[model samples]
Target chain A: MEMLMNPSQMTKKYFTPGVMLVSLIALNGLIFLALRLIFGVGAITNLDNQHPWGIWIGIDVAAGVALAAGGFTTAALGHIMHREEYEVVIRPALLTALLGYTFVALSVAIDLGRWYSIWHPLIFWNGNSVLFEVGICVMIYVSVLYIEFLPIVTKKFIGNVRFKGMLAKLNSPVDKLLRMLDRGLDKTMFIFIIAGVVLSCLHQSSLGTLMVIAGPKMHPLWQTPILPLLFLISAICVGFPMVIMESLIASRSFKLKPEMHVLSKLGSYIGPMLGIYLAFKVIDILIREAFVYLMVLSTESVMFSIEIIFGIILPMRLFFSKVVRESPLGIFIASMLVILGVVLNRLNNFIVAYNPPYATTSYFPSIGEISVTLGFVCIEVLMYRLIVKYFPIISIPEKAGVFKTKYSIQGSK
Target chain B: MATQGRRDFLKSLSAIGISTIGVAGITPSITKASPENILSKDRMGVLVDTTVCIGCRKCEWACKNAHDMPSGSIDDYENESVFDNKRRPDYSALTVVNKYQNDKTGSPINVKVQCMHCDQPACVSACIVGAFSKKENGSVVWDESKCIGCRYCMVACPFQIPSFDYHKALEPEIRKCDFCFDRTAEGKLPACIEICPVEAITYGRREDLVQVAQEKIKNYPERYNNHILGETEVGGTSWMYMAGVDFKNLDFPTLGDKSAPGVSESIQHGIFSYFVPPVALYALLGGVMWISKNRDKKEEN
Candidate 1:
């Protein structure tokens, strides 16, 4: 194991001042207060009966969950696939998943009308409802995520002799029992991993299935039985690219070593997934006989075309190209495009493309809604930074010379 | 070597067995509706003659009054310029009359839009909460009390009929025409049929309605189109239409015979029915995990 950074250096470099963090938290709190007090959803939001869900459901929840898919995808690749090189990025991806899911839970709390009655779904089972399936699955998966993160938390908290001794006395036979439980959990980790994958698949598809019930209210260009499948496939495609984006951003910001090798390897999976996704997307449109609608250059059609080109086709091309896949900057740009694509696809399905002929209302998220979303994102980033700082998250460390030289140069400057 | 091979075979068999077990646990019980139940031969419905409609908005008024809904004044319809553009059902309005210009008639056709009340109502099937249900007499009704307000019925209604009361704070209802299920239960015609001045909207047993529609087309070949709208669309609606011109000219969607619920529910059940894929996925992951764990153990030894 590499030597730890001295406490002073760690504190100076890693931890942002508490005041700045608190101010960010306060800003979010103020937004929450405004949402609760000043506005019913209509006062602040453009949502109507036509567009029931908006940016909160589409981007903040759906896209957020898809981005979090990186956790299971990476863990499955590293631990299950036994690609040990990818193991370095696993914990960060897990951290991302944890934060992403927490944000989804928060989004649900904000969006639900009877927010207090949220527990009813947990207590009462509506087996037939797709939302019920999604709600239950997401709730369970979030718990599973934190359980997966337990070892990292324990390793960080239970440090040397003093902490170990304190824990040891309390541990007793229960300690041995707990260790056995951990081993059993590790052995059965595949069950939860598979369960997570299954649940994610079910809920992600159900997210699109939620729109399937919208009938003629949904623009014909997007309304089809195949939407659920498209959503599931797109989620998997988005997962790898999101991981790349998150890792690259973290590496650049923290002056950590880049994981270009793993990212480029991930490009191989993403390229083909995008290809399969685009192929099926075209087939779905054709089969539904919705291709004719695309011929008319209406606003909906134009937006649809732009979404396909910019979100799917362009990103796929960039990802597939060897030169672009290998370059750090190229991969980063492609990852951004992929992320943008997923967001646009979800937003188009949920908001922009939802047309109720009786009620021709448009939605732009209120400032409060936008602030809450941003605040949730900030919280996610803060949690990630804190976890990585305290826990042995990423396996590859910054070269000693590189770290020293950078700090010395910064001091001199 | 022989024992090792036997053990590997056993492992593979157990993996497959585990997957099948998992799938069996979650698969929905397939209780197919009897063919008699499936086919609604005696299904009753209404046939609206759009050419005869006077744009009186009487149906709208009668439906609201009968259902005890809040009435909108003439100004509400006029200010919205509802006639200028085709209007659909709203949270407050269960039905609407829209003026459609037909080149064949060289005049306007006032088409009243409401729930088609499909023979196989997608809204009924798509509703997991049992909020929307089809009655024995053929009317599809919604029980708002059971609704968790998930709005699946809104999405499932091919006619775009179900409208939600999104503005309401406490208890918002999903508003749509129930084919006047309550009035029909009392052996009375729907409020719209009772109040229609022109007799443009006729309510009866759907079979009788179809005959009535055909007889009108046969009697006035010039006035009515031979085609009976909703006779086969989305596997037949409880409500049908007879138009002077082609239905498409009036902005009616030319949907296929396959019901929306049939397509979606089939896919839902097909993927989820057997629980096979998830089980298979688990077995694959488990096998891989076991192999890796064993390899690690060997290395340690």
Candidate 2:
């Protein structure tokens, strides 16, 4: 038996024009964020009584959560399925989910009118509220994501702990702490992995349930009792594709060979997963008699069509082809479609479907709102780049023994 | 007096005993906030007679005064020019009277708009932090300290009554008609009901108010629409309306008889019901993981 692969930090130039551009966008967002904090949500948002949520909830929290399903999906595949081939991609996926959820939480805090009172949901119980369920689940899941990510921290710094001057005295203690923590986590990691998958399922579905209470305020097309089911299925469908998309991008960005073998295999799984999602969607439409809505060609109908046709169906069809699954560009485009489709679905659910009675004007996100969302995204990219460059997230064959001691290193796969 | 006092004390003791038993009986719904037996029979409500309203907007003035939002003199509300555009309750005003044309007579109909204060308030059921509560007196009052200002209440509300103070970056409250809970608690009418010049708004026990609304419509079929706006809308609101025109013409949403939170709460309970589904899911995943890992190991061996 031989070690198939190992995870190692990428050695690359830390800064580039692209990084600078992302930092600028993040800074632009920070400016608006300061204005939002100093002035109010009203100052930078188009949200009013009729539209209490806008792009922040749609794109940042809901879409962000759905896209981050990669973490749990990859973890389940690698560790639970014992598919060692997927082990190389797991750390990157884990890092992405960790940062993805962190931003979801950060955006939620920013979007709250009383951001300071964000901790209120912890102590005050509201069992009837879907939002309450969502809040609690997301909070716990975020913590779980961090715990799932703790191994990376320990792996990166265990034997490598170093410091300057008088602080060097703390190095041995820190190293001892890391080693103990790593050992404890190694035994307990399975529990967190299972918990992570379960938590993701709970909150991803609960996000759709958040809008079910809106009742008649939501357009009939998107409003259904099976909303939570749809959300969960869609989240699951998007998981592997997100992994494929990110892995390809990371490979390209880091100038390393894409692990097409594992990804192509993952790609093969996407077709059937997507088919399940599309079947549920079509069955839902048929059961609800929602196809009549398609005939009208309104914005809702059009958006729904785009979501199904381009987002789910087309990508799904593309994935079935052995060529598409095997090609980098084809899989990337297919993955991008699924990602965009999920984003559109969330936006439609949160924004487009809502139609408050007596709304004098329809709501749109202000420039400030758009800027802030873009800023958070840029910051996320910058953080991801910084993390992989410095930490053992991307897989390489050298330095395998730093974390896992039993790699034998005898033969090749 | 001593003997009478003794009898009174026993009555009080029995009352406490009965209430505790009742509370124990319905504790689950209370904790879950569907509150089956908790809506008091004597819960106060308002019956708004839109046909009788003159659009004087005096109630609006009184509401602002009572809420201690900024206010103008009573004379300022008399301007008919404001009715050219429709109005809704916003941060500046807790209630507003909007005028609509009567198709039958071509005369203007004045409709007073505010919180319906439903028997089962969507706001109370939707608040992420349990900030909003449906009081025994039928007012859906929110505690400021508990509110994280998530604004899900605005989305949940059937009438879209909740408004926010978006201008204030700090402590932006979800402002709406509180049914004048403070005033009603002091054995006084809601400020708007008290100041309604035409007596268009009548405040009484919800049970009595429904009866009165029914009688009014029955006696003057020509004057009122056959339907009572809030009697069955979103599971009966504390503030019901008897409009001459269909409520839809007055910008009232046509909602079903089911409480707004019914489907949502059912789903929430289904998913988290005593944590059965989640536990089962965990066990199922654990099983799959075990089988898969064992299969992999057996293959290698």
Candidate 3:
């Protein structure tokens, strides 16, 4: 990145071959989604009475919420903790969170048998339910993300409003609304930032509480009373790595120089964060004497082993090393590993550990299920790319010919 | 409600639509339709004596017929071929009878499977919309109007009894033996209990049923297992069993005495206890942000 910088929308071509491929995958997924909506969830997915929640819940909703922790984590460091060096990553993180939650909401609606009644939770809330907690928090946090992203929208169109013919007269009022929104948000942004972090903590842990009710239905290895605490810690640990992973991927995709200084500084905290989570996880297993279950070589044990070895310990060791933290590629790999670890942990918890009695066959996501999940991911990437092309989300490129942030001139950190 | 015709279904739908809009006045903490699940000493229960059952499967036919479900004929139930493979209570059949080959007698020990109607039902605690309610009669009933069909109830049931209608594109139901809430409300015995030819199923007040079960076990020591299934399983269920052999061998999911939703709900209540934790965290974060900004401003000056 250039020594002097400000966030500017990219001028590069948007429709590359990679994006075209992604669109094709998105199209495939939408086709299956149509089938699901018309013919019911059973028609498109392998979900049965034996296993009600497939990878759509496991990957799209649970893992989606975990991976999108970047928004709040970065917000805490940059705004709450007043770490100005991390400010550049905040906009992009907020966008990722906004878009990530939209996918989660879409997945939940798709996963539910009655998509029309999805809004029922808002009025028909059951405080006793862990899922109710997850649903309400995710709903509010998505709105918070949208509110958090409003500044970028306002910034882009504040004075740049241009429309043809009669619509041109309304552009000034629209710009006035944006300016008013921008000013109001500036005063109230702190509340949303704090609320975002608090909401994240509540729902992230409540997600783990979701399976605690399953109790004996889940395997002994994953079933613990401290499941919520473990979930909270892992979510906190995964937050920075997710931000680093997203930042690196966005930079590489846009053909811009990565922000090594900020990312490496972010990378330095990963070791200790992951170390704390690992310690708690180990202590939980010891307290429960769950190692006995692991002694037997089963799908549950192997998946647990892979999640710990490849996800936590390996990345922790890497992040602890100076060589890995300083290089863009090395930090990127370590962050990706951590991200994958959290994703795998969520899948293992939701899919593998949930063992209902009288199940003659185990659950495996069908091709259509996989296609829809993959399609959601593809669409997310396409949105991220398009948003960065127009919005001032990525502030890493050289500031030579790019437009200046005029309204935020005096507000610069 | 499960087998209601199109007109009845539409009427129910309209009722639900109005109630949903009516919910606007009600606080989310206490929805209007959310029943107060008060336990009673006189709550009804059933005790199955497996040793007495002849495996006639008349109970299965009666259950479906009472629920307005299609069962070809009472003759079809006596085919005796369903015992070839173990079955669960699914959408089509709300109750099923399974025969376990027992060496104690030449005849197989037949066990009936359906919702336990737990004293502390996990489905009641886990339903996202509070759709399930445990009545004073000990029947755990679900409202079709309220259920979103997320199947979280199916996941939470320790006995794995609640089954969903996956095939229906619209208004799919979570089917389970509702302990014959309708029949019991009319002061009539459950259809299965009424139809039992051999008096295999004994229905009465739950406490009376427990005493009856204990008397049966004590009177014929060799004919029954000392333990009564569901007597203490998951904090006790409305339906219980007395078998000659161990229940684990009878294909019942072995469960502890603790309720299924106990840990999860405690954790939930602990975290949100008067919302103090979230509020304090908010204040703490605001304080840190204020101090950090002030320190930066001082340094700039």
The parts of candidate 1 lying over 4 Å away from their true place are: A1-39, A112-133, A154-184, A206-226, A279-305, A312-327, A352-372, A386-413, B1-43, B72-86, B100-108, B128-130, B183-189, B291-301
**Model 3 deviation from the true structure expressed as Cα RMSD, one decimal place:** 8.6
Better of 1 and 3 by TM-score: 3
- Clashing pairs in model 3? none
Candidate 3 TM-score versus the reference: 0.93
DockQ each candidate and list the results. Answer: 0.20, 0.35, 0.33
Q: Write the per-residue lDDT of candidate 3 for residues A317-368, one digit (tens) a residue.
A: 9999999999988998999899999999999899999998988888999998
Per candidate, native contacts kept equal 0.20, 0.81, 0.68
Give the whole-model CA lDDT for all candidates, comma-separated.
0.71, 0.84, 0.84
What's the interface RMS deviation of candidate 2?
Answer: 14.9
Per-residue lDDT of candidate 2, residues B1-301 (tens digit): 1112334433543453455456445536546555555798888888888888888989989999999987888998889999999988898888888999888888899988888888888998899988888888988888999999889999999889999999899999998888888988898888988888789899988899889989988899988889988899888898888887888888888889999899998898888766667766776776676667567657768
Residue A63 lDDT, candidate 3, scale 0-100 = 93
Listed in order, each prediction's TM-score against the native is 0.81, 0.93, 0.93
lDDT of 1 by residue, B83-173 (tens): 8766678777899888877777577789899888887777776664456666677778887556655565665677777777665544556
